[model samples]
Target chain A: MYAELTRRSAWHDVLPTVLGYIGIGVAFGIVSRAAGLSILVTLATSTFVYAGSAQFVLVTMLVEHSPLLSIVLSVFLVNARMMLMSTTLSTYFKQEPLWKNILLGTFLTDESFALGMNKLNYTDRKLNFTWFNTVNLASYLTWIVGTALGAMLGSLITDPTKFGFGFAVTAMFIGLLYLQIISDKTISLKLQLTIILFVLILTYFGMAFIPGNLLILVVTLLGCALGVILKHAHN
Target chain B: MPTIKFIFWTIFCTGLATWLTRITPFVLLKKFTLPPAVIEFLNFVPITIMAALWFQQIFIQQSGQLPAIDYLNLCASLPTVISAVISKNLLVIVVVGIISAAFFNIVL
Candidate 1:
């Protein structure tokens, strides 16, 4: 069943994420410091809150004097997609022990979940705990450390975009999407490309009307549904 | 600095909310049994999610009218795609993309 799963070492699957998290983590730290968050608070946020965008929103909304309830709502809305991801991830992790699933769930971020799914899904990668935890713990620890470094380096490294750090996450996504399509022989190249085009069009059209978080859910549901329908028809 | 109580509260609430969204589904759904079709559908989620995230980053939305393309990102994507196709390596594509960003940033 897992013949194609262990093609590469765990480090190979995780290095890009580890590197990108460090860079983004630094940026997050710098932003928190600039927003007047103390180093302890910054560490606590990254350690406890963990979700990158939500942490950024928490910092911004706090600065903007949004009420605590509103901040919680905003954070919830921003991270609602994680609910979908966590559900999808459960398809794989459901068999694990309760504590393991909970621990894995705690560490599941957008990057780890997406990367794991890309391989574990269309391709047959056996995502063992050893491998999965390596990706999660390494990325998590580095993110915390990187935020600490960025908080300390605050003024020295202003304007992270100057070094092109801004594009690292996007670049990683692009690369992963490319790999996801290219490696999967389960579906035809034509259908994979068609699905990509279909999802892009849906996202593009929905951008102006729908909110980012909700729009993603809508597009993902519609796009993947159509993809499955087309695949069945193709068969 | 913001007041200590405020910081602690925000951190506690935001962290809790984020954790729930992230952890609840696994805890909640693991108990139930899903049908096969739904499982098949979940397989398709990753690609669409990836595409959505890529789109949001690639194009910057203007409050009104069509969204404008970030030309720098567009230009950098060419090399990144090429590296993805050629090397099939994450490190290679990301490095290519970052380098492309630096190069385009200087020129554009």
Candidate 2:
């Protein structure tokens, strides 16, 4: 049964996820090291937090010697999307054992969530915690390994910023967006446009007065609300 | 304040904040099933969130200046988009983006 599920997963879908984790994981490690964090801290965050955007936000704030409030707020803002991710998984995996659901929910990063949803659609099977665990095992391992490598060699590798290492995360998002676009053109376009506008407005506000993290929260909530309206109107 | 105090506060706040946010959905959803309307809305959440993130990374200004166009980023991103469209290969897209970004950075 396990082998069959692995075989059923489109390697094409899994490949982007793995590449994304590696690239983004390395970026986080480099930034963490540059922030003066020990390798242990770097690995701990990557392993425990397991959320790329949040890790980056936390490390960046720590580097600036921002107050504890800022670090907490930044991570919360970046990871607010997890609320949505876990909600969807809950509905899909509703019948699964409670313990398993909680375990899988903790591992629900962006790529894993996307992959899990896609797998569910392709297989037309109920996604239990077991399937989630299998897919997430690969993701978690890659992320930890990539982050550790980056932490160890980050200082040696000069000019990470100059190399556009930062864009690795963006590129991964774009690639994932492209996949969404191809999968469902109409809805994805609308969602993409709305988010672009929201970001532009939020960034403007963030630059003007509000903190960056607060701006992110405001924009994301607004976007989520708008998306709900659009979905309802369409239906 | 001492550095140790700062670290302690950072860890405390970070840990608390992380735990609260992580637990919110699980706790809420366990008791109640989300309505279909909510579920449908959530479908679009990831796409929008990611778009916002990508936009900030690609377009946001670094220095304290008006949004000056980074022609290099634009040039690099344009080709990256093309490569993504043509090849649809993650590795190829990454290579193209990196090379283009590097080339433009050197030239400009």
Task: Report backbone clashes per prediction.
Answer: 0, 0
Docking model 1 quality class: medium
Measured against the true structure, the TM-scores of the candidates, in listed sequence, are 0.93, 0.79
Candidate 2 lDDT (Cα, 0 to 1) = 0.66
Q: What are the clashing pairs of model 2?
A: none
Error of model 1, residue B5, in angstroms: 0.9
Q: What is each candidate's DockQ, to 2 decimals?
A: 0.71, 0.43
lDDT of 2 by residue, A140-213 (tens): 88899989888988988755646655455556566555555555443646656665676666655454454455
Q: Candidate 2 lDDT, tens digit per residue, B2-52?
A: 275575566566655665565567767877888877776776666666556
lDDT of each: 0.80, 0.66
Docking class of 2: acceptable
Please write out the lDDT profile of model 1 over residues A91-136, one tens digit for every residue: 7777788788888888888888877866665445556666666677
Candidate 2: true contacts recovered, fraction: 0.36
TM-score (chain B) for model 1? Answer: 0.90
In candidate 2, stretches whose alpha carbon ends up further than 4 angstroms from where it belongs are A1-12, A60-70, A117-128, A185-210, A231-235, B1-16, B61-73, B89-91
lDDT, residue A201, candidate 2: 67
Candidate with the greatest lDDT versus the true structure: 1
